[model samples]
Target: MDVGQQPAAWHELAATFATIAAALFGLFFVAMALHLDAISTNVTVRARARVSLQSLALSVVQSLLILVPRQPPLWLGIELITTEIVYVMLGAGLRVRAGITALIAAMPIAAGISLIAGHGPGLLLQVPAIIIGVVLGCWQAWNTILPAELQTRRTVTKARR
Candidate 1:
């Protein structure tokens, strides 16, 4: 498709999110590497990290779907739905946090449906989706990567209030 054929907003949003996803993915990998031993030894940490990783993966995939050059929105829509379905399968055994990630992924599903139907906000929905994913990913990293004594100190401080 010609560059002029596609709306500027779609291309810009997709391009920006692609950048954001790449940067966040790198940060997540570093955070995980630092906490790898803790995450591996503790089942609970492993489980939480899995969901966090899944969330970051979803953000990356969603950006890629939109950034595919000149692809029709309908095709992108179909791809988003398919990706979310497979993502659900991948995170199947995970519990509440996984459920939250599933819900976060629902935005892309909705965005896809809207794009397919030729109405609604279309790719703009991805703004909130990626934002939430990055924020949650960072939150998880902070919670999962900090030293145990720091966490305990924070908890104790909070309890004193």
Candidate 2:
């Protein structure tokens, strides 16, 4: 068991790889179930299905851009635009504030513009993007964790049971 050896030399560990893959698949399925449950009331299952489809399409385009040596410019454009559109739709569906959503929506476009500009994105823009993303993420986490009436209803519901 030489730890420094490459993955290619681990061909004999097919069973271990299979076990890991199975575990990862199970985790992914469980996550999908939780996600579906969380959004079921506000978003219809069919709408969720459409979102998944759109996401899959964008993922394919992104993969091509990353993996292909000669990825088409059109594919990159499609991937970038579709991703932003999907993010915006998801943010609206989840009732996030417009300002926060707008900032999040602009992130990729900002990065793309910077890349196209050839000099690359400055640290100034990157720093703000990171800070904005972290702040918005924390705000959303707090909102989800402490919903209005959650504390009041929880105590009453516990007493009833």
Top-TM-score candidate index: 1
Reference-based TM-score, model 1: 0.76
lDDT of 1 by residue, 36-58 (tens): 66567777677667766776677
Residues 1-161, candidate 2, lDDT per residue (tens digit)? 22211223323342343343344334434444545434344344334333333333333333233333444333433444466676566544245456755665575456444434433441223234334443443343333333323544665689999
Inter-residue clash pairs, candidate 1: none
Root-mean-square deviation of each candidate, in angstroms? Answer: 5.9, 10.8
lDDT of candidate 2 at residue 111, scale 0 to 100: 46
Question: Candidate 1 overall Cα lDDT vs. reference?
Answer: 0.68
Off by over 4 Å in 2: 1-82, 120-127, 148-161
Error of 2 at 30 (Å): 11
Candidate with the greatest lDDT versus the true structure = 1
Q: What lDDT does the true structure give each of the candidates?
A: 0.68, 0.41
How much is 45 displaced in model 2, in angstroms?
A: 18
